[model samples]
Target: MPESATYALDTRGERMDALEQYFREAARELREPGLALDADPDAVHRFLHLPAVRLQQHMLTPARYARHDDVLPSFVPAEASCAEWILAAEWLAYGDPGMTLASPGPALSTVVLRALADEAQQDWFFGRTSDWPTWAFFALTEPEKGSAATELTARLDADPSGEGWVLSGEKMYIGNGAHARVGVVFCRRATGPWGIEAVMVDTGDPGFHAETLPIIGLRGARISRLRFDGMRIPPERVLGRHRPRSRRGLQGALQAMLWFRPSVAAFALGVGRAACDYVLEQRPALAGAGRAEVDGMIDRLNRLRRLLRDVAAEIDAGSPNTFRVSGVKMRAARLAEDATLLAARLLGPASLVEHPWLDKAYRDVRAFEFMEGTGNIHRRGVFQGLLRDDYFTSRDRDVRPGRVAEGVV
Candidate 1:
């Protein structure tokens, strides 16, 4: 049988094949530099000139704003779809999750911008990035509130000067926060959900302050803490002004999360694939239980990849199944942890000391749990979906009328 036949999910066609191959080649350059990046987060600057890094910097830019000479693969659509993003994310992350996160680009901010920002706000953002390689952040999580929108205390009050708005609060664990030239900050203007709002802020402002945190894994991401001390925001800078009050902040944040959850799952799958691949490559002749274990992991990884691709396609088709996306993320994260742990166990005690790449993979995979949302959070989402009968239908005659099969939910 052909290699593709081994995995039923390999049905994405020739275009996706070329895209995957491109990222696979790009992943090679990241392996060596990824170690250096782990040791010194700032080392990412040295590798920014790599083709993959440059591609990431502009991958999400709308075609009109994209440079005519941009060398993106012909498979990329005028407006890249979520499926496209997830496919690229998985393969590139398979190369190096840390480096993939480290490469400068709009990152999560692009999702929020597209969901909330008006035409002018987007122009200001894409224009700056088009001028040069730029990094942007999406600031929503807070030190105490932990991104619980209802509980967040960050305030965007009317300027005493009666001219604009004054942003005052702090955000924590924001990726690229320290180095970002521009970003979107979520804050509250009143008391309820509708009070929440997202605003565009330039880090160059005097009131904006950020510092990189010392994190154990995914160091190259440069996750940082940010404080806004009376940050000034012009009226036009407030996002979602043209939309209804109810759909401004929290809705946009949720929409962005929904769209990106598949990509997050893909990232986890990539790390897991890397770990499993390393183990098998190192022990090519392994047999018995160990070989069976690795083969089982490969099978599950293939299934998870298929699920991720389906979720991405669903999102792109405008029929996102929120619970399914969350479930995929939860399962993928667990598989990554399991895969890395299995790699370590099978490779023996000295494996980490001998193989730096496997060691990094172990550490890097842990951060995916905290990326979009924690496993507990996703579990709650899946549970909610179960309660609503979102996963099954009455048409499934095999399923009981009111009760799901054991372990089915």
Candidate 2:
């Protein structure tokens, strides 16, 4: 590596070290809610300005979001190595699952909107809004579907004018949907077949509307359902190229979204690690608890952390292993389940109690599996990848932590 590259790596190392310290301090802050003060809405909003537990959360949540964003640029940058970025994400999730869960909101999706938007629209968007506050409903999911981007079938027949198109369909299980400014709705063109092109619809359009969906878990995320009633959108909304019976528009957007699946997993690992940290400090308290169980749990968490780190390192090094990203995501999700279950056992009835960080971590981290293409889906992707001709020899496939499989949408 060049001296500049070496400097960048060192800088990232330092930044990650600092970020870890910040995460630890923030966790400490959450551990003491007497310090988390001003739960009052307006006061809480006001409190976010000052440097406190919540403020630390504010920074950390965005940091996790940025970690996902940072990976989108093909390689890790100087600020955060893939490893550090993943750790930061986990810490953020661990801090306040709600806040962390609410993250990926505007930051991750906006990167796609910015990349795919036409020049005029891009200029208009960036010129007016310095930072887009978007939590995408990712309109590909439907009430009864096989749950693939190709399964998304919102009609995308543009009006005769070509200036606008009408999108008519229902989108379910959108993240941060209750009150997000920007929305990316994927709809199939009216003139196409089953797996046709996707037009990225802007939610601000007249006929577009969004309603929240009540979900079993992740209450803090404000999951939503979207309905497009003759929603007229401009041509600039089409995000990717066209294909036979398929919309590649989602390809790019999905690139923007799915590329970070591993990062989401990394975020989960952080939560698991934090929960383990919290439990280990008080391991001797329980009646039947022994050092063996506690030590075993810690070892498991550490292993998960290392797993997350290895995938991140590979992606950063641009030599990601085959389906390694999926493996990491799957492992992280399982570890989260284990960590949360262990936390419940470690904390006893206190796991369900409020005013503490553990329960929120457990709740918030659960979104990891659901949001980033469920664990099983990615696993299947991994399985299919193992069978592909491109799987073994492609230079891109060599990326030990290459992006989640594409061309699915």
Candidate 3:
């Protein structure tokens, strides 16, 4: 019998090949000398605007976002949502990791809005942006509170007239914040069952200030620090106050992370795959353990990809195993980091100085370590799941630690 694919895609091989070529072309365009680094931000925006928006529409259309609510339509197969995201991330990584803003920002916004917004709010925002590419950001990370953002310091004080509110606080490391058209800014309400509330803030608002913060990797992302200095927003601007089945505050963020972590790993795998391909293509003469390292990395990367697909399958089946997802997240992050390091060791100093793509890949891989959740955090989650006897409980097939089967999810 032929091998079973992890994703259960009807045409996995053909789809991947076609998708790879599509993104490879985009990556080639962006990787052109002086284009990615020196092009005007607006120019880069123009280049990516259409492709980005179309990609988002494809991912969210046909009732796919319902998967986030733990509901999958019968028309969509169990692995369909996961397949969409994995392919999306793979393509984004192929284009340039920085281009990730095209997806994650809009994706998080959609999740937040669906979870917290009323029908009118959704229609107003989603409808308006349906035509042109619009970016939305989830601003939860503050300067002081890195990953532990449960205790919000940002405050949302109600207007004395009982009509609107004033937001006063700062958020840091907001991906695509500087460039986002809309932002879901999370803050603590000053009154009435006070808790973290998400407020929609238009970037053009005078009090909504955003400045791009450059990073070593994913430079094109336009990550920013946002200062909401008494920004006034109408009452309806707030995401609805109704409590979701899941706890609010960190719970919302956690839920987003769970849904997104596997996809995040897919991007990391893309980075690693890019690096590995460079090594194979260059055929660079290597020193001790360099060739062996590259060989080992190939096998490891394949295993990680299969594992990620499996996690996605479980999630699609309406049994999101957080432990499995965390394991995949932790492993994929380490693999990306390790694969890049191995490639660097194989290629020597020349890879960093002479190969811009490889260098970018190296820098991009680092962000995966921190994106969605950190390695330590994911490891902790996996351990906690293990303690609760929930680890791998829903996996379609048994997978022992360090002994994953090929082509298995």
Q: What stretches of model 2 exceed 4 Å from their correct place?
A: 1-10, 26-84, 103-105, 114-121, 124-137, 190-202, 241-247, 282-289, 316-322, 349-357, 384-409
Model 3: CA > 4 A from native: 1-30, 33-35, 38-42, 49-54, 57-80, 102-105, 190-194, 242-251, 284-290, 394-409
Off by over 4 Å in 1: 1-12, 68-71, 392-409
- The TM-score, computed over Cα atoms with residue i paired to residue i, of candidate 2 is 0.72
Candidate 1 TM-score, true structure as reference = 0.92
Over 103-188, each residue of candidate 1 has an lDDT whose tens digit, in order, gives 87777777788888889999988787665568888898999778677777899999999999999999999988999999889999
Among all candidates shown, the one with the greatest TM-score: 1
Clashing pairs in 3: 310-409
Better of 1 and 3 by TM-score: 1
Reference-based lDDT, each prediction: 0.82, 0.54, 0.67
lDDT of 2 by residue, 1-409 (tens): 0112322334656756655665555444332332232122112222232222222222322232332232122222223445655665666566554444444234344445443555654444333223423334345577776346666667877587767677788878776554555566666664333444545545666777787665544454566777888887676656544233332555545554544676677667667766776776655464455446656766766765665576677766767664657766776777777877777776667666842565555666677787666878777766776776433335445545634242111
lDDT of 1: 0.82
Candidate 2 at 267: error in angstroms?
Answer: 2.6
Q: Which predicted model would earn the best lDDT? A: 1
